[model samples]
Target: MAWVYLIVAGVLEIGWAVGLKLSHGLSLAKPVHTGLTVAAMAASVILLGLAARSLPIGTAYAIWVGIGAAGTAIAGMYLFDEPATVARIAAIGVIVAGVAALKLVS
Candidate 1:
């Protein structure tokens, strides 16, 4: 259950990251996008806190951030037409590996 919370939180982190990009620096002109981004951000944090109740802070935080970073990078490439170079893909892979390792040890 805690892992579920953490995974959802990490996914919401990706949502907000993409939302932030869509929000155009959170400009008032993009109120809808900005609002959604803020909401997702809040939810992500709340879920992270819940997960941290059982998971170690360091491990949880690292996994949370790792998921966010890797997922956001992938999202950018697909949704925004960002480069899908080998180096970028490899970096994402490394982040995923690190996240898996942390989960295993914890």
Candidate 2:
């Protein structure tokens, strides 16, 4: 259950990150996007806290951030037409590997 929360939180982190891009620096003209971004951010933190109740802080934080960073990079490539270079993909792969290693060790 805690793992589930953590995973969902990580996904929400991706959502908020993408939302930040969409929000255009959180301009007032983009109120909807900004609101949604803020909501996602709050929810993600809350879920992270819930997961932290059971998981080690260092392990949970690393995994959460790893998922967010990797997932956001992928999202940028697909949704925003960002570069999908081999180097970028390899970097994401490394982050995923690290996250997996943390999960295994924890």
Candidate 3:
């Protein structure tokens, strides 16, 4: 399904986002880390393009970005200990709800 691909693409977007943090610039980036980051970035864009074929560009892009932001925020909290404040969690919840709403409306 188009939604499935979109979801996968969004997850991969999270991958690259976190990957960028871990990569720590080209100077410190390891071969494996850089490779995986590049691979995830490429795959995510490819899948996003595929999903756009069936969905409105604005809606698809919003959903993709929403999912990526939510996933990355949560991941950063757990993996990087960024922050786990209640307000931050609530914001993530709202983003998730918005993503769901867009999916339903579309």
Candidate 4:
């Protein structure tokens, strides 16, 4: 149950991130992006709240943010043709490692 919420949170994080990009600084895609972003954030808050029952704040948050960053970066590169430099990949790796460490320590 908690894991489910966390997973939903992760997906919502992705949704909001993609929405932000499509928003084009909230100029053209204002309504669509704003609506999606707001919904995603609201979903995320509910998810984190549910996950708090079983997961530590530090651990859950690190995992959520790390997965969101890695997933979004990959999606941006493949779906949107954003840069996929070696350094960027390495940075994602580092973020994943940090998330893993958080889990391991707990």
Q: TM-score of every model?
A: 0.98, 0.98, 0.95, 0.84
* TM value for model 1: 0.98
Clashing pairs in 3: none
Sorting all predicted structures by lDDT, with the top scorer first, yields: 2, 1, 3, 4
What TM value does model 2 have? 0.98
Q: What is the lDDT for 56 in model 3?
A: 97
Model 3 alpha-carbon drift over 4 Å, by segment: 26-28
> Between the candidate structures 2 and 4, which one is better when assessed by TM-score?
2
**Candidate 4 accuracy as lDDT:** 0.82
Query: Comparing 2 and 4 by lDDT, which wins?
Result: 2
Q: What root-mean-square deviation over C-alphas does model 4 reach?
A: 1.9
- Please estimate how well model 3 matches the true structure, expressed as its whole-model Cα lDDT: 0.92
The residue-by-residue lDDT of candidate 1 on 6-87, one tens digit each, is 9999999999999999999787899999999999999999999999999999999999999999999999999999999999
- Give the alpha carbon lDDT tens digit for every residue of 8-88 in model 4: 897788878887888775555488888778788789878988887799987788788877888899889988999999999
Decide which is better by TM-score, 1 or 4.
1
**Weakest lDDT window of 10 consecutive positions for candidate 1:** 20-29
Candidate 1, residue 101: how far the Cα is off, in Å: 0.5
CA deviation > 4 Å runs, candidate 4: 27-29
Question: lDDT values of the candidates?
Answer: 0.97, 0.97, 0.92, 0.82
- Clashes by residue pair, model 2: none
So what's the TM-score on candidate 4? 0.84
